[model samples]
Target: MIIDYGATPPIEELSIGDGSHLANYRRVYASSEKAAARGEVDLDQWFRDCDAAGIGKTVIKARDVETTFGGRISNEEVAEVVARHPDRFIGFAGVDPNKGMTALRELEHAVTELGLKGLNVQCFENRLAPDDRRMYPLYAKCIELDIPVNIHVGINFSLKSSPEFGRPETLDRVLCDFPELRVCASPPGWPWVQELLAVAWRHPNLWIGLVAIRPRLMTVDHSGYGPLLQYGRTILKDRMIAGTAWPMQPMGRVIEEIRALPVDADIADLWLGGNAQRFLGM
Candidate 1:
């Protein structure tokens, strides 16, 4: 019952479609996008990989690129897949909060009408700060639904240079202001992993993904997960989930990265998918 809170990009505008997707792995807009596409980890393939890896499920999110990713893959595309595999998938609606009320309405429709459970809000690009009270109504909606709102974290993403206004710290304001909100933090500028850890630790309901696999490809020691595991145990273990972050990076690579680590079997299992299962309440 593993649940990946982060996934998807709407395919629109660019010939490549999604804002991050690049042609021939040339320069997809975002690093995750490049990894997902060039790495060949779209929804279908990712599910297949996850199934093989014993990952029971992943919450899929679509693109609403008013500010960031220009919907590399449309919400309808994701909806169809989830509808097809009602048991294997959970869908998160994507929206540009920058659109204000319209964005809020779309999110409600995505959850209620589309049968989706969560939201992948690109608050960084919304041009509207996450702490701003404007998003309170939407936050309330999520709390009412009891679905986790996975926000971008630790990642310094520039959506076509569209003013990345989102940050992991901003979520602090949201959580402090609204105690009921449950959020899953996704990574990019993992440079801020410490900040994410601190916030999630302080707020039981605030969760962050321990982004695995490809990122390990960059670490010189291949033991980056070691510090992550130790840190998880120390502070945010209960608030952590293993997020393959598909459509941006291959799920298999993440597993491999974890495999290479010197973590004990029990702790390692959590990073693979166990933690996600708990957070998703599976």
Candidate 2:
């Protein structure tokens, strides 16, 4: 049972607008030929692809960057998808921290009323550091709701934002403040892979998501992802999560690469699905 922890499906509501900052980074992360196009995606084909890749569930996120970038994937839109295919999709709600109390209300609605299971925060895109005070309320809310948060913790390709906003060290403070908050810091925290690993080591509630990255690269020496493979099979075996960051890469290739990593069969299973099942309380 493979659960893709992070995915931006090709739905109309989740489509990237031309004026959005994500347009600038699309080419960098999006490998699919159709990814460059605007408008509704072939939803049927997307499900077919997931089936072929053996993806049992995919977590789709609604992103709200309205305060800074005028972008949003409304919770209603994400809920719609989950409503149609509850067995195949898990929805994560997005709230802009700059919205202050409004953001907290939105998150409560997303989880309780809309049935979204988690929160997705893109700090860089929102122009706030992970430990920024504005984000604390949402973290607290996640704990109150007993839902996990998936945070963007590594380099962001958007030219409009600095990668410093995503520095893994900032996460350490957030984790320290909310020790009970379940976090999935994603894209494997590259360029600071070791630092993120150290943070993950310190927090049992933290899990690293191998999203928007090439899994096979971790097996190569000097790839800077070596420690993840080394420690993931040992100390961090239960703390690793797998995600395709789909449309960034093909689902089959991502799953194949993860399965091909040089770890014991059981450890590989943890990275691919077991860990997420536990994290999502499945």
State which candidate has the highest lDDT: 2
Global lDDT of each candidate = 0.62, 0.88
Candidate 1's C-alpha runs over 4 A off are 8-48, 67-74, 162-164, 212-227
Which residue pairs collide in model 2, if any? none
Instruction: Give TM-scores for every candidate, taking all chains together and pairing residue i with residue i.
Output: 0.78, 0.95
Model 1 C-alpha lDDT per residue in residues 137-166, reported as the tens digit of each score = 889888887776777665444534322354
Instruction: Give Cα distance to truth, residue 154, candidate 1, Å.
Output: 2.0
Which whole-number lDDT from 0 to 100 does residue 158 have in model 2? Answer: 88
lDDT of 2 by residue, 1-282 (tens): 999988877777775445467666666654453442322447787888889889999999988988888888889999998998899899999999999999999999999999999999989889999999999999999999999999998899888889999899999999999999999999789999999999999999999999888898998889889999989999999999999877777788888888888898899889989999999887
Residue 280 error, candidate 2, Å: 1.0
